[model samples]
Structure formats: structure tokens, C-alpha cells
Target: MSGNLADGERAGAARPCLEIACDESGSDGENLTGGNTDVFAHASVSLSVTAAAAAVRETRDRIRSPAEEYKANHLLREKHRAVLEWLLATDGPIHGRARVHLMEKTYFVVDRAVSLLLDDPEGAVTLFREGRRTFGEEGWRAFLDAANRLLRVRPNGDPVEIFYGTADSLARAHPGTDAARILERLAATRPRAESYRAGCADGPPLIPVLNPLLPAIVRTAALWSGDGRPVTLVHDRQNMLTPDRIAWIEQTARRAGVGLAGVRLVVARDDARVQVADFLAGIARKIASDELNGRADPALTALLRPYVDPASVWGDARSRALLADPVAG
Candidate 1:
């Protein structure tokens, strides 16, 4: 699997460009709070179409499942544990060619709220890291719930009213507490919400903090473009990547000093590389979710460690500990 262009093609280029296939799992758009899945995993793979197809064919031969399309679930069943281990092994086809960004949904909401509502987002994040120890679990839960509601964009509701109402409810529920103080600070940012509403009234509605996919895509582009090379991403077709959103992603990447050549959308079934990425993403999400729930399989965890991106948006101490574990590497 390689991303190198032909020498003739490279001759006229200012810098080398690599093209990679991408797919995601557990994507519920901006519905972070009421979404079906708690984890979002986006995967990118550098494999060529032929190489990816061969890998898939080999896996299918090993599993011998009758299904027309292979998915992560086929590899996850207990009966196919050996095949799963082999697929994720360091010596496997995807070893160094893949990357996955796994985010815990609740944590993402908290992070977004802090960034949007607080003056010192970093300080607020550090304080919130103490979790139930600093603010009682119930109080913390209430704050997160309120924040999620305030940030979401509804088709028919007044966002400004939702903002103040959410903040007021939290203050009433947990008066004089740390959580309430946070909500008070958030209420002070009512002007920001008003600005958002004004902007929405003028143009397409914007919920900057709701969707996690944009940031994830930016980070993935940065990772693939680490050598100062431009990256062209081939992704599974998704409704969220509208023309405006794709332009935003490209502009954001440029601002961050990453050279993103372009983004191309294709049906996963038509593209073998995208299919391979789909499998990797789905499996990674399930494994990460299991780890979050304290039901991780040790062997699977070890196999998955190499592909987990270090900058993934995980906000729990257990998640940090998992990343720090030398044995898993």
C-alpha cells in the first residue's frame, strides 16, 4: 500500500501529494447528546485500491461469511477472534497505513461548551478534569446536559432563549456550587448566542460547536500531511460534508499550515480503500466504547493501540491512562 505518485506526475508539482481513503463510524451529525452512539471514529488509510481490495478478499476467504458486504461486525464476533487479531496485528496490511480519531461524545460537548462560554477555556478544562470530585456527579451531569441543549441548533426554536433558559435552570438546580458558577459564566456569554442567532438569521444557520467531524477531518489532514506534502482525501459520501463545509475544512486546514489538496466523496461499496477504512473505523469505535465501559478485551486493546491517534478527543482519566499504558503499545 502506497500513496506515491509517478515520477512524471511529480515533476511539475511543487511538493509531493498523497491521496488517502477515509470512512467514519458512529456519526450522528450534531446530535451528540441524544445520539445512538457514544463514540465517533474517523479512519484514514493510505492503501491503493488494488492493495485494499486484495486485503479485503483475503479476509473474506479467512472468514468465509456469506454476506455480500463485509463489515466490522463480521470480524468482531467471538467466532472470528483470531481473524480480527490477525487483521490488526503489527505485521498486517494496514499496520502503518491507517489512523483513527476516536472521540467520546459527552466529553466533546463539555469541551465545546468550555471553548464557547468561558474566557479561559484551558483553565476551565483543567478544573473540570476533576469531574465528580470538584463538582458532585449530579451537578456535573446537569451542567453537561444544559450545555448540550444550549449548543444544539433546532429548526424552530429561539437559540437565545434556549441559552438563557438552560443557564437559568442550571443555576436554580445547583445554586452556589461550582457547576452553578460555570453556568453563571455561561449566562454572561448570552451576547455570543445572540450573535450566533443574528448570523443565522442573515445566512445558513451555523452551529460551530455542534459537529465534531470538521475538527476531526482537519486533524486527520494534518496527520497525513506531516511531511509537508499535500493530501487528497477520498471519503465515504456523507450529508454533513456539504459544499460549504468542504470549503470550510480546506480553509481551516490551510490556516493550520496543512496542505490539503482536495476531498472526493465516493460510495464505500464502489471503492475498496473506503471499504477498508470503514471496517477499521467501525472496529475502532466498538473497541473504544468497550474500553470506556470497562469491558475491554485485553488482546484487542493491544492490537488497536498503534492506530489510535494521540490527539483524539477523550476527556476521561481512564482514557488518558489507556493511552499512557506502555504494555498496550
Candidate 2:
């Protein structure tokens, strides 16, 4: 299926905007660490808007799967290595090239943020839902302070253990306040910072998975839209792009001095370009996972390295360095 805007709309559209098709793997916002997958990945492939429609049709013609829809993981499992090699090849319909950013869940104290919020449920939930949204360390600190003020604790109870009794006490003590409202707000806001924390004594503070992913996507958009056209992003349907995450992406892009004309989420089966991105992202995810597990596949690495964008590999500088010099590290 085509991903480009229709002919009638092109005249009104921005002059030089780039259209990007993206896909992801191993993304579970709430269960980043507890889930089976540890690494969260987002991969984007960009193309000039002028070429997008044709490219989508052409790419779809190349798929050999019997299934009505195509997915990256499926191809990797069933097809010969050449199928992946061909997809990532320079001659493929993908015009702008592929870039991927991944975050390893273990590198940061993944559970600290959520656990902290859980401990001070009343305070944590209040700030998360009511406090002005912020990013990085500065934002997290402000949230914590705001949340602490809303809680009542004994001298020994640091976070004020929140339970049924605590809720009842809070409701009785503050007749005007709604304890149920607080609980509802907390449930809604918890996932916003589920993978983050104010501080982690064992490791660096948690960077929400989306923080890195959005920036990387924006950078790619900037590169593709250098000609003065706005950028439009299209991605496969996934949980990572929840309303809060989308807000975070736009906010983050603004902070980074980047612009996105539009962001579209579509089913992979309905969009050929996203299917192509899925294939590429799937390959990258597998390779990265293998490297992390110390089961590097030299043949596969050698085949795919030439297709990878040097700038948009995994997030860690060390991982990039290792990918560059696998034997040395």
C-alpha cells in the first residue's frame, strides 16, 4: 500500500517534507525490565515524499511471503539470509536508509523509578498527574518534591506506606480531597515514568525509553528534511506510541530544536513502507541482541554492517565502538 499523501493534497503540503516509515521491537513501557525482552528498539527508514508512493508499491512487489502481510521477524525466520541481505541492500526501494536506537534495560536501574512511586503512592501519583510535565533529571526531581508534599508519613515511614487503611485515613483527614481520585490519577500517571527514576545509587538515572527513541527519530527526520521540508513520520501500530509517549516525542523534539509535521500510526499490513521498516528493524534487533548475549554471528554482522547507518546504531557509545571494532573489544 502507498504511504504518500494524495495528489490533491500534495499542493497544500509542505514543499520539501520527508516521509519516514518506522517499526519497533521489544517495546513494553510498563514492563521494561520484568518482561521477557530487555532491549527496546525503534528503527526508522526515511524517503523523499516524492518517491514514497512508488517505493511502497515497489517494495511490496518484492515480498515472497505467503502470508497476506509481511513482518520482519517472520522473514528472518523463514527466508534465506539473502532475503534480509537483499532488503537491506543499497539497491532496495528504501531511499533514505535505516537508523536504529536501542536501550538495554539492565544498564540502568530500571525498576527504581516505579518502585519509588509505588512506595509513596499518594505523593508520587499526585505530582505525576497534576504537576507540569517535564523531562530528564530536572523534571524527575521536581515531580518527587511535589509528590512528597501530598503524602502523610510517620517519622519512620519515608514514603508513607499507602494502603487501604492509609487511603481511609487520608480521606478522613482531608474531607475535601478524594482518595479514589488520587488512586485513579496514580494509575493513569504511573506508566508515564514507569521506566525512569529521580536517582539510582547503583547506576545512572533512568532515561525513559521514549526519550532516546524520539530524539533519534527526530535526528533522522532532520537529516532527511534538511532541504527545508517538514518531516512526517509513519510507524507500525505499537504500544510505544501511547498518547503520553506522543506528547513526550513532540515535546522532546521541540526541546531538541527539531520539527515534525505529522506523526502517523498505521497497521504494517496496510502500509508497505512500514513493512519494509519492520524487516530492517527486525534484523538490527536480532544482531544487537546476539552481540549483547556474546553470541556474535560474524557472517550476519558482516552482511548487515554495510547497510546500517553509522550514526544510528545502539544508544550506548561503547556499543557503537564495539560494533565498529568487534574483535578489539
Best by TM-score: 1
- Strongest candidate by lDDT: 1
Question: What ranges in model 2 sit over 4 Å off?
Answer: 1-15, 48-63, 108-228, 240-244, 306-318, 324-329
TM-score of each: 0.86, 0.56
Candidate 2 per-residue lDDT, tens place, 25-87, comes to 765443433457656566677654445446545445655556665566654764455666666
**For model 1, how does the per-residue alpha-carbon lDDT over 1-329 read when each residue is reduced to its tens digit?**
23455667656567667888999999887678667888999999998889999989988999999999999999999999888888899888899898888888888887886786675666455545754454566756655566676666643456567557856775676677665677667777888867755665576553267788888898889878876778999999988889888998899899989889889999999999999998999999999999988888877887888888877887776775674233321
Clashes of each: 0, 1
What TM-score quantifies how close candidate 1 is to the native fold?
Answer: 0.86
- Write out the backbone clash pairs for model 2: 16-229
Model 2, CA-based lDDT: 0.52
Which 10 consecutive positions of candidate 1 have the poorest summed lDDT? 320-329
Off by over 4 Å in 1: 1-15, 131-139, 155-180, 201-207, 324-329
